[model samples]
Structures are given as structure tokens and as C-alpha cells.
Target: MEQAVPSSSLEQSPLQQVQARIAQAARIAGRKAEDVTLVAVSKTKPAEAILALIAQGQRVFGENRVQEAQAKWPDIRTAHPEVALHLVGQLQSNKAEDAIALFDCIHSVDRPSLVTALGKAQDRLGRKVPCFVQVNIGAEDQKGGCAVADLPALLEQARSAGIEVIGLMCVPPADIESAPFFALLDKLADDSGLPCLSMGMSGDFEVAVQLGATHIRVGSALFGER
Candidate 1:
């Protein structure tokens, strides 16, 4: 396991590098770098590291597992009360209720039943939370996402069920350039009237931004490998 850096060192260490990447991406996109939200994927990473990033003004974060997040959320929330947490990993139906209680956004929702589950969970929680339609743009059998053709109907169903489908999320094939997949998601979000496109990661965020990614999920690139 990786130990967390002390607050002082973490505050000074990697923030400049993160800011530079965001600046470069924004320049390429012709948008202010400040407009792009960077979500540090913090799964398996210690809470102290999260505090270091929060000290540098990074607010949004992504977690891959509900259990891991549950373990970290309250402690981390005590450290940074305003941080936005996104569920960027596969969500099991059994865990939907708990996820609804934690995440500010669910980024890997592909099934209709999951959407229904979220709606019911939100009703119980008495809040409307934003969601993303995960698209398996790579069409990988091992991946979790809706078929590209089914997104329209899924969005419609989501809207009617009181779950807001705000955009799309995808993990492209490792060997393929991410721009095409990002473009496909951009087209879908635009055509569907969803303004946010949550795509890309530490590896190919530059390509994602050029292709109109509104939010980026970066892990190793920002916090180093877990």
C-alpha cells in the first residue's frame, strides 16, 4: 500500500503539474482551464493524500468501489466538506441504495434497472442527483455500459423516472486513440441535449479535451499510482 504524503509536502508537490496539464488542455480546447473540472480518481489511495490535493484546491474526485468510498467518505468529508464525489466504477444493483446515499454523480450507469434503482433510492433520500450514461464505445464484452443504440431510450426512461441523465462516460479500448470515442460521446450528448461529457482519464485527457470533454477522471496522473 502507498502511504500518504504529509500535508505540507503534498500541498507543494504535484499541484503545479496538475495545473499545467489543465492549462494545456484548456488552451487546446479554446476554453478557460478553470472551466474544466478535474476529478482525481482516489480509489485505494489514503485519505491524507486526498487532503493534500484538497489543500491545493482540487474539489472533484472519483472512486471505483462503493465499499472503498464508504470507508473513506466520512473521514474525507470531515477534511474537505465541499468536495464532489463521483462513482466512476461498475455499480452493482445490490449496492445502488448505498451508492445513492454517497455519490454526487454516478458515472457508470448502463442498465435501465440501475436507473430505476437510483430513482427509488433518491426518492427515499429526497434529492435529485445527477447521473451519466456509460457507453461501451469500445464495445468490449468485459466492460459495463449500454449499447450505443440503446442510449436514447435509456435517457428517456431515466428522465421519466426522476433520474437526471446529464451526460455520457466511456473507457475506450487501450490501443485506440480516445478522440473518436470522445467524439461519439460528444455527438450523443449534444443530440440528446445533455451539456456535460464526462470522459477521459490521466492517460489521454488532452485528446478528450480537444474533443469536448467537460469533465475528466484522472488518477495516477495526478495522485500517482495506487
Candidate 2:
């Protein structure tokens, strides 16, 4: 008879599970898993948890709140200087400066005014922080993103301001699968000449990847429940 394995030996760590998921998604997309970045959404997760993930070779992470990030940044930076941090959530006008200082990328540039504010902040910091134009693909009232029709004009304005518009980002309504939303963003990216598409999360990332997601913002799947 085969010996039974212990639970401790069988259990996968959060980071391992995340890497597996990324690999699976990439396989479905016909792309290498290394080609897609997994931005571990570390918003409210503890410092220890983040460190544990870092120890497992997960480098990129995303955070939602500026204040929460501010509380976590010092230690995370000190311990993992190579880690790339992204602000994947909404940026308040008041926190734009702090966000620019903390994140390598801000993935939620939804409004024209926010773009202007980020441009000013980037100028002050003397660094062109990469960013994504958030699109409300589902047209949900509560979400913050530029309307689909406004994207072209917005990209044009951003280009003229010298802001490096690297890609498009969006969050589909809670009930929607990410395929359609991601496909729409992919179309928009094709039209705008941008290359990156930031979509997908814990529940729908597989769909996002198959639809051509270059960057996926995965949360609970990596960190396990908020």
C-alpha cells in the first residue's frame, strides 16, 4: 500500500499556488508564464504575509489604499528593494503625490483631471511613472474609469502632456466574466497603439489571460481572502 502524505507536506503556500495559477493561465493563453506578471494585491494583508510571499520569489505586488500602503512600504522596501509595487486601485486627488512616490505603476488613471494631477506629480518627482487608463467597460455607476468613448480623446490628451500612457486597465462588474471586458480593452489597446492590458483577478484571471492579458492583478488567489 502507498503511504499517506502528511497535510503539512501536501499543503501549498500562497505564493506557490499563485505561481501555479499563473502557469496554468499562461498555458491556456499559449504564452510563457514568465511573460505575464502576477501583481499580488497586498492591500490589507499583513507584513509577515507579504514577506512570506517575497521569500517565495514573488516580486511584484499591488496595493489599494495609499494610507495602508504608506504603513507597509518602509519595511517592504527595506526588505525587498527589487520588488515592484503597483497602485492598482483608485487614487484620490489628495494622495496623488504619495502614490507617485510609492508605486512603480499606477494602474487606475480613469479621469482627465486625475491624469493631469499625476502628470504634475510626475514632473515634480522628475520620473515618468508608468500608468494605465482605466476603462469602465461594464459601465457600472459605482466604478471609476473613463467611458469607452472618451478613451481615444483621453489618450491623445495624455500623449500631448508627455505622460507615458503604457496601457489600459479595467475592472468588470462583479457578475461579469473578464473575457468580454478584457477583449474590449484589448481592442482599445490595439486602436490606441498601447501594448499592455491589465485585467483579471482571483476569480476570472484565466479568462483574462486567454483573451490576451499582458498583466493580471491577482488578489485573493495569491494571498487568500481579504
Candidate 3:
């Protein structure tokens, strides 16, 4: 059995602040606060930061790298059985099996090969992990998401491969107004009949929530600058 972290209000403040913001944003959107799930992005941060948030009662967290998450999370999850892990970074088809065994949700299913790999891994593991198709909403050449025009076909492939796609994900180009991009993702998700929208980060989560984000990947706001 794993021991829980010792509690402290000071240590819990960051999580509280982010949660409050989520609630506020949800209200502004005329949506229930409970409808939004906050995935505290924990990539590149130390285990202590995660432990602190765990102590603060945060159970869902996001990681960017499979290897880094593999290095830290097993021990942490051993201590906290209820925790849910999400993969919020680009995924390679070769890493499908490892990722299927580790993450509860995969937020970067962008291409057909990766989709097929994840499908095979899920069948082998006997555990179907929910996925979110990442859309290149801004059409940035450097991003990992699929082109907006390619989403429908990619989604069809994921479904054909027996992958359960629950939502859509995106990382808008940095240092720009993200509201329009967020709105675009929401529309795309709606058009695709996806029930969840995994948008927003530490900086613009509130705007994202206002624009209908179902899952907000917040890092610095909850764990403080890594």
C-alpha cells in the first residue's frame, strides 16, 4: 500500500487556484463546473511537485514523454492507486505498446499509423485506452496534429482500428491569442461528434473553458513554473 502525502494548505494553494479558475470559467460558459476535468501537465517537473499536488488531492495528471513518465509514475501510482495518467504529447507509432500500458488517456492520435499501433497495443493489453485526436487547428507546419482537412479520415481510421476516440486536442501556436483557435477546436470537435475537447494550458485555460473545453491541460498554474 502507498502512503499519501502529508497535507498542507500552503502546498495545496496552486491546485486550488487552478480549480477555482476552472469553476469560474465554466460558469461563464454556462456549463457545470463539474463537467470540466483538469489534467495538471507534469512534464519536465520533478516527482516532488507531483507529490505535492497529489497531497492537494489532484488525481489526474498529464505527461509529455513516455520515458520520463515511465521513470517516475510507477512509484507514484503505487503510492496513489486512484491517480489517472494522460499522455498530452506527440506519440510515435513504435511506442504504442508502452504508451497503452501506461496512460489512461492518449491526447495525440494524429496519424493513421499511430492509430493502428495503438489499436493493436490495446488489443494485446486487453485494456482500451480512450483517445483524443489532435488537430492542427492553426495549420502550423511544425505541430504534431493532423491537418484540419485530414481529421475525418483519420477519425475513421481510428474507429476502423477499434480505437475509442473520445475527444480532440490541440496546441495553438505560441504567444498568440488562443481564443479563436480554441473556438475552432470546439467547433471541430462538435462537427466530428466528439464529446470532449482537450484544449487550454496554464496561460489560457480560462478562455478555453469559456469556449467549451472539457479537459484543460494545466501545468505551470498548478505546479508552478518547471
Candidate 4:
């Protein structure tokens, strides 16, 4: 993994390089770079790495587990007080409250049970997290997204439960052309009236930007090998 380097500005660091790529992609797609939010996937990276990026003005970060973020982020947030943490992994229904307590946004609300759990947690804690309903865009059996057909029902359930679903998220089948999957997600978001899309990663993010991805989760590209 690339060691986090302090004082790395937008001109030469890996983070800056990724940001530049996103901007170039957006420009090529006729969209403004500022509209595409780059969520640095900081899962498993140490606090030093996170703090280094923070010093570089990276306020948005993503984590795979609530427990991990809880352990490392409280002190960091207490110090910076402006960081936005997002949960970008499969979240168990039982962990809804914990997820809500730490993450400002959640990108894995895929089932009715999870929606119900999150709803109760929100009501009890008075904390509302902007959510993204992950879509099994490739129909992969092993993936964690909601099947394409079930999205509408699940979204309705979230609406009834007062969960704020902000967008659609997906992990396309690996080792294949991701554009089709990204394009499909864009269409699904349009049909569902969602304004944002959290698609793309280290490999296919530029394609995702061209296809209307509002948020891209880039991990290895920014932090190096996991």
C-alpha cells in the first residue's frame, strides 16, 4: 500500500491524481467536476493515512465496517470536526443503530428488514442518514445488492419508513465491461427518481462518470494495494 504522505497537495499526490482524473472524466462527459463526489474508500487504512489525507483537505471518506470506523474515527472527528464518513459495505440489519451513530451516509440499504431496522434506529436516535439502495445490477448471485426487480418495493418500504434514500449504488460483476452495468444503474436511478448514483471504483470510475455517476468510491487507486 502507498504510505500516506503529509502535505501532499493537489498537484502531485495520488489523491490529487485521482481527483484530476475525475475532473477530466467529468469534463469529457460535459459535466462539472464539482458535481462528482470522490469518496476515498479508506477501509482498512490506518489513522495516519486518514489523517494525512485529511491534511490534504479530504473531508469525505468511506469505510466497510461500522466497528472499524467507530474505533478509529471518533478521535479524528473530534479533532477535525468536519469529516463526513460513509458506510459502503454490506450492513447487517442488527447493526443499523451502530451504522447510524457513525456514518453520515449509507450506501448499502438493500432489503426491507434493513430499512425497517434503520427506520427504528433513526426514530430512536433522531439521526437520519442519507441512504443508497444498492442494486444487483449484474444479477450476480453472490453480490449484496437488491435485485433489480425488487428495487421499487424496497424503495417504497424505505419511503414509508421515513428513510431518506438518496440514490442507487452497485458493484458490477468483476472482469467484465462495467459500462453496461453503470449505464443500467443510471437508468434505474432515473426511473426511481433518485438524483444521485454511487457507482465506479478504481478501475471503471471514468466510465461511470461518463454514465452519470454522482459519487465514485475509489480505494486502491488512491491508497494503493489493499
Candidate 5:
């Protein structure tokens, strides 16, 4: 008879499982997992929940709102200053300064007005925050990203406004095939000479990985259901 092994040791934490999936996806794409950055989407998760992942070695996180992030991250940052936070939602023109103060990166820059606000904030604060220009790949009116037709003008405006535009971010239409959308975003980023692509989420991140996603925002896959 074969010896029995410990069942406890066979189970993997959610974070580990996600990381393993990321690695597998990267390998399938002939890419290094180290080249991919997983932004643990901690938006709406409580402080305790975030700390659970922190204990599990997740150092980068994504939050959707400035006020909510302010309420949660100050103490968390004090405890773990190495944690890098990204603002991964629609940023309001009024919240630019606050967003600048809280997030290490802003991934929702879509309009010229927002670019202007962020630029002014960066100037007044005497610090610069790198930003990802969110592109509405599917051109959905309800979404927050800029329209495909406006991308060039917006990028130019952001550059002239002095915002550190680092790359592009997008959210594909829900319940439809996301690969084509991801592929388009990848092409758009490449055409614009941007080096980073912040696409993918809990469900379609693997596809995003295969298409050159530098950052993947994973929420439930890493933290379990809300």
C-alpha cells in the first residue's frame, strides 16, 4: 500500500493559485511571469481583507476610488510602505490632487480635462504620478475610457499638459469575447510607442497575458467572492 500524504499541504491559498495561473499563462505565451505585474484589485475590500493578502506576499494593489482609498490605505501604507497602489477607476477632475497624493499610479486617465487636472495637481504637489490612459476599446458609452477616435488627441493633450503618460488601460465589454478587444488594445499601445498594457481582469487575464499585458487587475480570483 502507498503511504498517505497530508491533505492540508495539497491546498493552495487564493493568492498562490492566482500567481500560479499567471505563471502558467505567461509560460504559454512564451513570456516570463516576472514581466507581468499583478495588481490585486482591493477596491471595496476591507482593510483586514487586504492585510490577509499582504500577509500572503501581495505587495501591489488597485483601488477604484480616491476617497475610499484614502480611508483605507494610510494606515496600511504606514505598516507596509513597499505596497504600491494604483488608481484603476474613473478619476474625477475634482479629485486629481487627492488621487495624486494617494495612488502611486493612476490608470483611468481618459479625457483632456482630466489630464489638465492631473497636470495641475502634479505641479502644485511638486511630484509626478505616472498614468495609464484608459481607452474604451469597445466604444461603449457607459464605460469610462476615452473613445478610440479621441485617443491621439488625448495623448497629445496629456503630453503637453506634462502628465507622465506611461501606457494604456482598458476594460472589454462584459459577456462578450474579450480577446479581440485585448488584441486591439495591444496594437494601439504598440502603435503609440507606449511600453505598458494594463488590460485583463479576474476572468480574462490569461488571454491578456498572452497578448502582452504588463499589468493584470485581479480581484475575486485573488480575494475570493465579495
Candidate 6:
């Protein structure tokens, strides 16, 4: 596991380097670098690391658990009011209300039940957070995304329940060439008429941006291994 760095060291260099790489990849793909949003994955990382990134102008962050985010982010957000928090891990239906209260976006809405729960939460809270439907592009049994065949129905269900379905998200199979999977996700987003694709992580985010990823979740590169 990688440990967190001190806040004093969280300068613009790390973020600048990543941004430069993203720009290069986007240029190669004929897309503007500004079109891709970099979401710093802060799972298992300390609040200090997040603060450091924020100091460097990182406005977006991804967290893997509702409980963990709840423990640290409320205060953090209070200090940095412009930050946007995203839930990028498997979310239980029972935590819908809590998730809705904390996150500005959700990238793991992969089932009809979660849609219903989130819709109800939105109605109750009078807030509509953008959501991304996770697709099981790799068909991995252990993954949390909706199966490829079930995507359309799940999307329709989410829309009908008053959830704002903004885009599609996926985690490609690990230890394999990811461009093909990224391309597939882009194709799926195009076919569905969705505008956002939240794929790619620390290792393959550049490839993901080249393949039309609108949002890339990066953790280790920004923080450290965990």
C-alpha cells in the first residue's frame, strides 16, 4: 500500500504533468483536452492529500465508499466549497439517501433497484444528481456493472424514475490491452446517445482519453498506491 504525502508537497507539478499527458492524448485523438474531466480518485487516501490536490486546483474527486467519504469530506468540502465529489464504487441501495446527500455525481448506477432508490432519494431531497450507468464491458463475474444486454432497459428505467442519466461508465478487464474495451465503451455511449464516458483509471487514462473518455478516474497517479 502507498502512504499519503504531506500537504506541503501537494504542488502543481503532479497535476500539471497529468494534465499535460491528457492534453497530448486528446490532441492525438482530435479531441480538445478540456473535453475530458480528470477525477482524482481519493479512495483510501487521507484528507491532507485531497487538500493538497485541491490547493493545486483539482476541483473533482472520486471516492469508493459512502461511509469513508462521510467521515472526512463534509469538513473538507466546507473548507473548499468548490470541490465536486463523485461516488465511483459499488453502492448499496440502502445507502441511496446518504450517497445522494454527499455526492454531486454517481458512476455506479448499474441496476434498476439503485435507480429506483436514487430517484426516490432525489424526490425526497429535491436534488437530481447526474448518474453514470456502469457497463460490464468485460463480462467479468465479479464486477458490479450492469450486463451489456441489460443496459438499455436499465437506462430507460432510470430515466422514467426521474434520475438524470448523464452517461455510461465501465472498468475494463485488468492486465489486458484496454483500448479495445475503451473503444467499446465509447461505441456504447454513441449508440445510446449518452454524452459522457467515465472509463479509465491511473494506468490507462491516457489511452482512455484517446478513445473518447469524457471522465477518467485516477487514484495512484495523483495520490499514491493504496
Clashing pairs in 6: none
At residue 39, what lDDT does model 3 achieve? Answer: 97
Alpha-carbon error at 130 in model 4, in Å?
A: 0.5
In model 2, the runs with Cα more than 4 Å from the true position are: 1-9
Model 1 lDDT tens row, 62-124:
999999999988888876779999999999988888998899988998998998888888898
The reply for model 3, stretches above 4 Å from the true place, is 1-12
* Cα deviation of 101, candidate 4, in Å: 0.9
TM-score of each: 0.92, 0.93, 0.93, 0.95, 0.95, 0.94
Model 3, range 3-79, lDDT digits (tens) per residue?
77756534648888788778888988899988999998999998998998898888899999999999999999999
- Overall lDDT per candidate, in order of appearance: 0.86, 0.86, 0.92, 0.94, 0.93, 0.94
Write the residue-wise lDDT of candidate 4 on 13-130 in tens digits: 8888888889999999999999998899999999999999999988899999988988999999999889999999999998999999889999999998999999999999999899
lDDT of 6 by residue, 1-226 (tens): 9999866546547788789889999999999999999999999999999999998899999999999999999999999989999999999999999999999999999998899999999999999899999999999999999999999999899999999988999999999999999899888899999999999898999999999999999998878788
Q: In model 3, which residue pairs have backbone atoms overlapping below 3 Å?
A: none
lDDT of 6 at 74: 96
- Alpha-carbon deviation at 83 in model 2, angstroms: 0.7
Shift of residue 61 alpha carbon in model 1, Å: 1.0
Question: On TM-score, who's better, 1 or 6?
Answer: 6
Q: Encode model 2's per-residue lDDT on 1-226: one tens digit a residue.
A: 9999767635978667667777887897788887778898998999998888888888999999889999988888987899999999999977888988888998998887887788888889888888899999999899999999999888888777678889999999897556777888899999888999899888888788778788889888877887
Can you tell me which runs of candidate 6 are displaced by over 4 Å? 1-12
lDDT of 6: 0.94
Locate the minimum summed-lDDT window of 10 residues in model 1. 6-15
Candidate 5, run of 10 with poorest lDDT = 5-14
Q: List candidate 5 segments past 4 Å from native.
A: 1-10
